[model samples]
Target: MLVASLTAVGAQEGPSGITQRTVFAPFDPTQRGCHKPPGLTKELAYVQENEREFLQGVNHGLEMAAKDRGLKYLRSVAENNVPKAVEDINAYQAAKVGALVATSSDPTAVSSSLQRTIWSGAFVGTIVPPPATLLLNAPQYATGKALADASINYIKSQLGGKAKVVLLTQDTMEYLTPRFEAMRDAFAKTPGVTIVADIAPTPVNKEGGFVTMSTVLLANPDIDVVLGGDAVVLGALKALRVAGKDRPNQFLGGIDGEPEAVSEIKKGNSPFKASISLSSPVFGYAMGQFAADWLDGKSIPQAMDILPIALTSENMAQYEADLENPAAVYADPIRKSTYLKMYGNICYDTRDQYVNFPWSSESSK
Candidate 1:
C-alpha cells in the first residue's frame, strides 16, 4: 500500500475550522508562520529511493535551491531498500536537519520517523503518501488518461482504429492503481482496441518490463500500442526491437517524461510517441524554497500538485529548458503553473495540521 495507516497524530481541524480532504483550502500563511528564526537551520536532506532519472531531477533542483537559498544539501540513496531508507531518515533526524524530502518503495516503514521529523519543528516533504508538512502528489487518473488517450488516438488515426495493445501496469501500488484503471476505462471505450496483455511487471523497472513483455510476446506476437510508465514502456520497446516486432506506426506511450522516453519520441519514426510528465525538478525546487521559507519564519503551501504534461517532440525543447533551469521556472508564475499547483498553507507553528493521509486534488470533486 502506498499510503500508511493514520497514526495517533491524525488530522485535526485547521485554523480556518476546516477539516482535511483530498484537496485543501487556499493557504492561510498568517496562521502558520515561520517555524524558527532565520539561519538556525540550513540543511536540506533527501532520502532517495533509487537512482532513477525522475528522482535525479529532484536532487538536481534541491541542490540548486540549496545553493541559491544558502542551505546545505545532503542526500542518501536507499536504493529501494526499506531499512536503508529508515536508517537514512533517522540519521538526518539525529542531525536535526531543517528540511527533508523523501521517496520510498515502502512509506510505512519510514512514516514514524517522518512524523518525528515533523514533530521536531522541521519541514518534511514526501512524494504522494503523507506524514509531511508539504506533500506532493500527481493527479493519477488524469495522468493515465492523457497517455491512454494519446495512444488511443494513434490507434484510430494510424492503425485504422484497430490494434493490439499491451498495458504494463503498477497495480501493486494501490495509490497508483488509478493510472491503470484510467487506461482500462479509456481503452474500454475504443471498440477496436484489444488489450493483449494487462500485467504489472515484477520489480516495475526496465528489466521487469523486458521480462514481462518477453513473456507476453510468447503468446501474442503482435503489439501495436504499448502504454505504461516510461521505464517499463522503454523496456517493452527494447523487447519488441529484440523480437524484430517493432513497427514504425506502432504507438508506445508512457508517463514520467523520462529522458530515454523523450529520446525515443524524438526519433520521429520510433514507436515511442508520448510521455506524460510529472516534472520533478520544478516541484523539487519549490519544495526547497519552502524549506528556506520555513526556516525563515515564512508560510508555505501545505501541499502541492506536480501537474502532468504530455511530452511530445513538438514541445520537447522548451520542456528540457524548463527542466534544466527549474529555479527560473519557479521564479516565473506562468511557467511554474504549467508544472505545479499549490494548496493550503503550513509553517512550523501550524504543522500539527500536516497531511497524514493519501491526498489528491482530483478527489476534490
Candidate 2:
C-alpha cells in the first residue's frame, strides 16, 4: 500500500505485520554540501517493459544522459514478459550495476528483484510502485483533470457541450484510480456530457483500445469524445476510422502526448486533440542525471513528480525540442520547473531511507 506522508520515526510493523520504514524528510532544495562518495561502479542500466513509444522516449533520454555523464549505459527489453523483466533486473544486480532504472508490466512480480538490487547498495529507480532509492510519478488526479477539462472545453465549443463520451481507464491499478475518479467527477457536473462507456481496456494497449471501442460502437455509435492513455485511444481512433464513424468536429483527446497522437492532433481535421504531455524523455533524463549523481556520492531527489502539460499544435514544436534536448531543459531552472517537481533527498550514505512504498507528491497532500 502507498504511504503518502513520510514518517520520521524508525521502522515499525504495520497492521499486516509487515515492516515499514520511513526515515526521510521532505527534500530540502536549499540544503547543500551533502555528499556520499562514490562506492559503486559508474554503470546505469534500464529494464524496459517494452518498445512502446513512451518507453522508447525514456530509453532515448537515459541513453543521452549516460553519454553526457560518462557512464556506461545498458538496456534490456522485457518484451512485456514479467519473468524476463525479473531476469533482467536480477542479472543487472548480480553484475553490480551501480544505478538501475526499471518499468515493469507487473511491478509486484519484480519487487523482490528490485529490493535485492537496493540491498546491494546500488541505486534503484522505479517508475512508480517502489522499493527504490528514487521513484518517478505524476499527479494522477491533476493529470486526469487536465485532460478532462480540455475535453470539456472542446465539447462545449465544438459539440454544443452534449456528447456521448468513452473513457478508457486503468482502474485496476490502485495508484491510477484517482485519475479516472477525477474524470468522472468533472463529467458528472456537465449534464450533457454523459459517459456512454467507462471501462478498462483489456491489456491496456492499442489493440485493447481498438477492440473496446469497436464493441462500444455496437450500441452507442455516436461517441463525440474519447479520453484515455495514448496507445489505447489511438487504437480507438483507428476503430473509428475503419467504421466510417469519425467526424472532423469530434473531440478525441488523450493523455501521454504520444508521437502518433501528436501527429493526429497536428492534422487539424482529425478528431484527436489535446494530449496531456507527461514527457517521459524529460523525466528519464532527470533520472539518469540522478543516477550519475548517486554514483558520484552526490545528493539527489528521492522522488519526482512529472508535471503534466496539455499539448496542442501550438506547443508541440517546443515540447518536441525539449524532449530532444532534455539536458538543456534540466539545466535551465525555469524550464525544468515547467516539466518536473522533485521532493525528498537521498545519497549513498542515507540509502537505508530509500522509498519502499508508493510515494507521490499529490497523495502526500
- Most lDDT-accurate candidate: 1
Flag regions of model 1 displaced more than 4 Å.
1-22, 28-40
lDDT of candidate 1 over 191-300, digit per residue (tens)? 99899999999979999999999999999998899999999999999999999999999899999988899899999999999999999888889999989888887888
Q: All candidates' TM-scores?
A: 0.92, 0.91
The Cα error of candidate 1 at residue 131, in Å, is: 0.9
Per-residue alpha-carbon lDDT of model 2 for 278-338, expressed as tens digits? 9999999999998988887778888888899999988988999998999999999999999
Give the C-alpha miss distance for residue 347 in model 1, angstroms: 0.7
Residue-level lDDT for 120 in candidate 1: 65
Model 2, C-alpha of 29: deviation from truth (Å): 4.1
Worst ten in a row by lDDT for model 2: 9-18
